[model samples]
Target: MILIADSGSTKTDWCVVGNSGKVLSISTQGINPLVQSENEVERVLRAELMPAMTYISDITDIRFYGAGCRDEMITVLERLLRKVFPAAVNVCVYSDLLAVARALCGKNEGIACILGTGANSCLYDGEHITANTPALGYILGDEGSGAVLGKLFVNALFKGRLSDKVRTAFEAETQLTMPVIINKVYRQPMPNRFLASLSLFIGRHIDEPDLHRLVVDNFRSFLVRNIRPYCRPDLPVNAIGSMAYHYRECLEEAARAEGMRIGTVMKSPMEGLVRYHSDI
Candidate 1:
């Protein structure tokens, strides 16, 4: 059996398959060795993941693709998975960007992007990444990501750039006061998540002109800063994430303006990932 995992900041999607076909599909709390300590990962596995794996013993290969999974973090996650999933004989971890490349582009070359809780991109030649522009964390960058969109919305609201009507609606919907926003942003443990939560409001109010402009501008920044540099005239661009999938119209407009075409926009990588791993 093979266990394939795709993880982001908010959650992890798991697929367990055998030689014949799929066995199970499940989700669990996301694990990022970059953020969570060794003990933290173990605790979550004990409490949440291990118990849920009914086919744990059958899993012979484990492939994990995740956000914040640098080489150091991959080593950390490998050790933890080895301890937790003792029955597994082989384990490998990869960055989530690779997952997008495989899922979106399959065995073809193109530009692959991630725009979920965070944002990232890479130029892929079917099997390997050729180039990548760093997706600096939300605070410093990650233009078209959920966290950055939320940050843009909140900043506009506070900076008096938005109209009184929009501001009033935002305050009421989010129930956020000046003090609360400050405390939530500065004192929060996962500020990126907190900021991303605000994106729901933007999505719901997408028809509003102000909010629409905000979304468009966010995608523009993504294309200009992340996608433009790696773009080739003939190569297609593809994305996988909640942000890109939900606001596809704006994303399309941005790409069109750049004289580029978007090839695929999957909300999550599970379906394509399942296909990609079937042979492996």
Candidate 2:
């Protein structure tokens, strides 16, 4: 059996493939190693993954592609998985970007971009990554992501640039006062994630022209700052993420304006990863 996982800031998707290349089960959980502590990661793995894999006792191999699995975090996750799947002979843990690359580009060469709570891009040539643009998190960078859009929205709202309807909708959804929002941003932690949460409101009003421009401008900035540098003017780019998939038209428009072509926009990589791994 082969176990593959794709994890992001919000959730983790798991796929178990049998010897015959048939997927036995799929599961999900919140296991972002960047945001959660070692104990927290172990808790979720025990509560979520172990239960899901109850029927399969003899696992032979496991591969985890996850967010926040960098540096020391990667070592910790590897140790934890090793303890959990003792019967498995091989286990590998890697960054979630691998899942994006494998799912989007597979054995072909292409540009693979991720636009989620954060943004990242890589140039892939079949088996390896040729180049990668730095992802500077939500505060400094993360151009075309939910956090970036949220930051833009908050700035506009506080600066009195947003319309009455937008203000009302935002207030209604979050039920947070301006002072509270400001305090959370200035005083609390994970402000980027908090801001990114506000994109849900923007997503709700995508049909509204003013709201649409906000999304487009942020996404455009993301492409220009992050993706454009790595990609040639004519390179076809494939995107993976909820924000990119949901606003593909705006993304395509932004790419065209920059003389680039948009290829595939996948909402979730789990299914595609499953297919890709099954083939392997």
Q: Estimate TM-scores for all models.
A: 0.91, 0.88
Question: Global CA lDDT of candidate 2, please?
Answer: 0.82
Reference-based lDDT, each prediction: 0.87, 0.82
Model 1 residue 255 CA deviation (Å) reads 1.1
What lDDT is reached at residue 269 by model 2? 80
Q: Deviation in angstroms for 59 in model 2?
A: 1.9
Compute the lDDT for candidate 1.
0.87
RMSD of each: 2.1, 2.4
User: Tens digits of per-residue lDDT for model 2 on 121-166?
Assistant: 8988876778898988887888999888888888888788888988
The model with the greatest lDDT is: 1
Q: Least accurate stretch of 10 residues (summed lDDT) in model 2? A: 19-28
Give candidate 2's root-mean-square deviation (CA, Å).
2.4
